[model samples]
Target: MEVFVEPQEGSPFCIRIGCSDTVLEIKAKIEKHRGIPVYRQTLVFDNETLDDELDVEGCNILDGSRVWLIVAPEPPQSAKIELCVGTLPSVMRLPIEVQVNDPVKRLREVVRSLEDVSLERVKLYADGTELEDGRRICDYELQDNSSVDVRIKPPKFMVMVLPWKADLKVAVEVKQLDKVKVLRKELEKLQPSLELDLPSEGYFFIHNQSGMDEDKSFQWHGVEMGDTIEVFRGTISR
Candidate 1:
């Protein structure tokens, strides 16, 4: 008689076997057809998991009967490690369990899942060094109970714009990914009354007392919240 094996993820397939065939024998036939290991395959009939030692007839499995096949995922090769993740300046730390071989990117994903934050904006650090996504946890020599820092990247932040000749300072809001050119435009829009010709007057932006690249983003220049961006009456050649 033929029994239908319906996998959790894919279409069902037929497996021809005798009624006296044991569940283990049926699983062997499935492995031959599906290439799924017998140990990883769980067969369910009539909402009950079938025992490997029981015969198909004893389990009341007849021809055209549908048997649900659940394939288990591969087990982790390495032992699980516990790490404490805490946000900056926050005393509360959350314990996260992960495989030692798991990548730093996976750690960030775990944090994002538990916290109310986006995965792309999540940053993880260990031992004063920022973790790279492609590198594994073992690469950082992170041991069990090691503390990891989680910082959420802010979408928008404020920056102080200081004019070179004038003592007046204007606060402008900008995104972390905004380029220096965008910042200049934002400044112009915020104070339209000011007679500032950033483009025509050859005006440029400065950060940390150094001229900033107009094409570079605020994140590239490491501009933080309330950081001063000095405006000078000059143009950058490059």
Candidate 2:
């Protein structure tokens, strides 16, 4: 008998098999035709998930009948490794259990969740070496119960400053905790090197599309990394 298997994704295809063939045999044929692993396939007939041991005829699956094929997601890593994560300054040690293949960023997220600290402020290190965000824990060759250090560092971001009537655009590094006025001073300090004719603090105002308040910190204004701050030679009237 020939059966039509409709996958959750992609076009439906037909498979020719014996009526007495088991569902597992049908899955094997599908693996041969589609290269999808048999274990990842879940076949549903008449709104029921077919057991692997059930035969096509026993399930009342007739020739040309349509069956739904659902591809299960990849299972999580089963091998869990424990690590001793310590936070600096406070010297708080936390025991974290994570999959061996988990990314370093995932570890940081776990720490952030357990400690209730901002993910941006969290940094993980092992043996004084900073763990990169992109690499997996297994890539570091870290074994079970390895000692990892977490540090809370103030996050800083760079902003592009386009001076009024000038061709040069300077990139200034600023911290989230710094007030908006501090951005002006940092730009002023670069006046000699960049040959920019920026007016003194009060005379000129920085605009991020809208006029930014000098008294407010960058965090308060929702200024993020790589944002552009335009400088205009005019004061914002209250």
Candidate 3:
């Protein structure tokens, strides 16, 4: 089968190979034909990353299917890297090219200029890990063409979750980004005896004096660090 290979910054090429050929084999072919090193190549098919162990058929790559081969800039010794930045539910990514030795503060400045958000508000996460402002990009082990999650920090306030029926009040800290579903799952782990009947419709957040409101986010309903919210399962019928 013949497949189209599109590099990040080069002309697309076609390679002839068998259906059972592994991605590593294809990378080797690319290295031999195009003089691109296999270590610096990051392959993507149908918007998903292709692993070295996966064969052509396993990736659902058919004949004439175009695969992305994101190659690092040459000079082999250069510390340049291409970074992708975006939020969730959106595959769109803004490409950022910078040196690996560059401090995160400089990168944050660039992001702030491009995104029009304050440097303090923008946070970059890569590989499920948050990037620290004091460290260099290389210190985080970010290679060429890496994906980074760019999120603007919203106003955060802590809230305490307490059992509504019981007198027990555990002052557990809560963040604004905490989801109701995730909290319920954690609560279930902490207290297996309590039958938390959280409904699919939504859960309720009730303050001692404020009463009940089915607000999705804790911050939306004016929940603060010292404020204690009673946990009550939603009574919606399935």
Candidate 4:
């Protein structure tokens, strides 16, 4: 059986385990290797999570069956550690849980979009069978070593037009503490609160700020000078 598993950022990408192993064991393995937060991670099979005190067998993962463990990204919104205080726009996160013998479920979390954000609402199967209930499944059995692609819609915002003198092109990556601050300052120009778009993920990380507070919402995320970020830019006159 060929199983493909996708773990979110700061997560273990792939692994193989016997049906005999419990979900707890999987968590232990992740901690031993990756040291991920146990509480922050969720083990999902057929794209669903097991409820509290729920056993892996409840989901009925068969021999050679594949499972996905998703570690949700932490909300970027945080109060400033500096003396300044401010609020950032809230990002949305949706958790999905499904039961065995049930149809497949798709979870969607949208920051600015209202729709569920799924390319396909229904999960179709031709050979054996399929079952689902309001994003919950309890009966349809999944094939061992199978693969399912889960996609969440990316948050959309308006493009930022910086009047800065530097000739900026599309930058795929940005690294440097000072550089991030310089970019955030440009965002501040737009309105002390603007979002930037990146060509890719895992762009950068910032060390904690001890003196800042009001700018709490303004996290110092690494930004390449060329990467494009979207903002509302508010309504424009016709």
Candidate 5:
């Protein structure tokens, strides 16, 4: 019978085994193909972990069945570390459990995906020094419970002149630390020259942009520098 085995962190493949093949036998096949030792291999099916001595027949593992394989993680040479992710606008703190051997780029990818921030904007720092993506977590020599700050670079804010008499729009270089109210104030000063009226209560919103709360900074909105903020009249709706 052919069985499908998927690794926890690597590629998945199919292997052929007889009905009487033991779990250890399956581990041996995986070890041959993936180089993970049989002793380190763990197999689970239907949410139940299978014992090493269990055979395919006893486990009731049929052909075309899928098995989840988790190879034991490498021991940490140093102490286990915790990563704290801080993203702008919301100033969210995400605590992540990580091993020393994990790649720094992997953590960056996680933050980038979670915050919806661009790869260039995602910055990881340990101590006062910036952490490079190509390095490993161990390279930082971070102690247990050490906080890693995830800062985002400021995206450019494009203020689209609403009631726009012209096709052109004005672009503003804004920092992630800058608030939406400040952005609106800047627009109020600039819009007069374009015959655009930005009322004292005027606010900015980007259509289809998630988390466009005017009270929050651009970083919180996951907005890119080139993205436009639609001009809205009156106060911002909650």
Candidate 6:
């Protein structure tokens, strides 16, 4: 039977070995075939990333199974979620709503600091309630009906000075696991919204590169108040 493998971009051929070959042997061979080593190349079976150091002894293989070796982007799933940024943020309070496709996360509450230049923070809450001083969004899950408020705090000096002049809002969106997986591709075409005026303060259209919202890209050209949203079939080259 013929086996299908996900070919890395620009690679000539995919490495195919017998069922008896261990993952180690496969890696060694792939390194020989390609310029990269087994350790460097990420191996994925059915979209699940495989650990390179682990032995292939317990990894049962079948005849038609496919293993792809690609120069993958960093942690594909997390990037998938954050790439939806500039769009509305999902709610992430505790006792969160559960969904079948909810990306399983160890997130709880976030006391965001709009106070600093670098948005990076350490991971605070792992189980839900506890807080790690400087953590990242990757650590948290945005649950349905849960509002993730990025509280903006003012900068502090050496002494205790009251903080003021910081404007922030509790930006929120509903999170449903099942809803996310369905947004894996781009929309063939977007539906035009009713002739409505998108206020400069309330709205700016996000690019529908991932087909998540099925909304088309917003063009600033000729767009004015009381104009209708134009829907088109947007395509990506790469």
Q: Best-fitting candidate, measured by TM-score?
A: 2
Stretches of model 1 off by over 4 angstroms after superposition: 1-76, 156-173, 176-238
Q: Could you estimate the TM-score for every candidate?
A: 0.38, 0.40, 0.35, 0.26, 0.34, 0.25
- The local lDDT score (0 to 100) that residue 178 gets in candidate 1 is 82
Q: Considering lDDT, which of the candidate structures 1 and 4 is the better prediction for this target?
A: 1
Off by over 4 Å in 6: 1-4, 11-14, 53-57, 72-238
Cα lDDT tens digits for candidate 2, 131-222: 87755687556778898988887656898888878776788998877899998789778888888877655455555667888899888888
In terms of lDDT, model 3 sits at 0.73
Give candidates' CA RMSD values in order.
Answer: 16.3, 17.1, 11.1, 20.0, 17.1, 20.9
lDDT per residue for candidate 4 within 1-238, as digits (tens), equals 2234457554335455545556665665665656664444577777678543444566686655666767644322331111111112222333323223232333112211334444443233313233222322212223332322333333332223332232442222223333333444444454323334432322222223222222223324433333343322222232
After superposition, the stretches of candidate 4 with alpha carbons farther than 4 Å from their true spots are 1-4, 10-20, 73-238
Extract clashing residue pairs from model 3: none
Clashes of 1: 0
Assess each prediction's global lDDT (C-alpha) against the native.
0.84, 0.83, 0.73, 0.38, 0.72, 0.36
Clash list (residue pairs), candidate 6:
91-146, 101-177, 101-178, 102-177, 121-134, 121-135, 122-134, 122-135, 123-135, 124-132
Give the least accurate 10-residue stretch of model 2, judged by summed lDDT: 199-208
Q: 59-132, model 1: which lDDT tens digit per residue?
A: 99989999999997644567788999999879789889989777789989889888778888899988778887
TM-score of structure candidate 3 = 0.35
Q: After superposition, how far is residue 177 of candidate 5 from its true place, in Å?
A: 15
Model 4 / residue 136 / CA error / Å: 28
TM-score, candidate 6, is 0.25
Q: Which pairs of residues have clashing backbones in candidate 2?
A: none
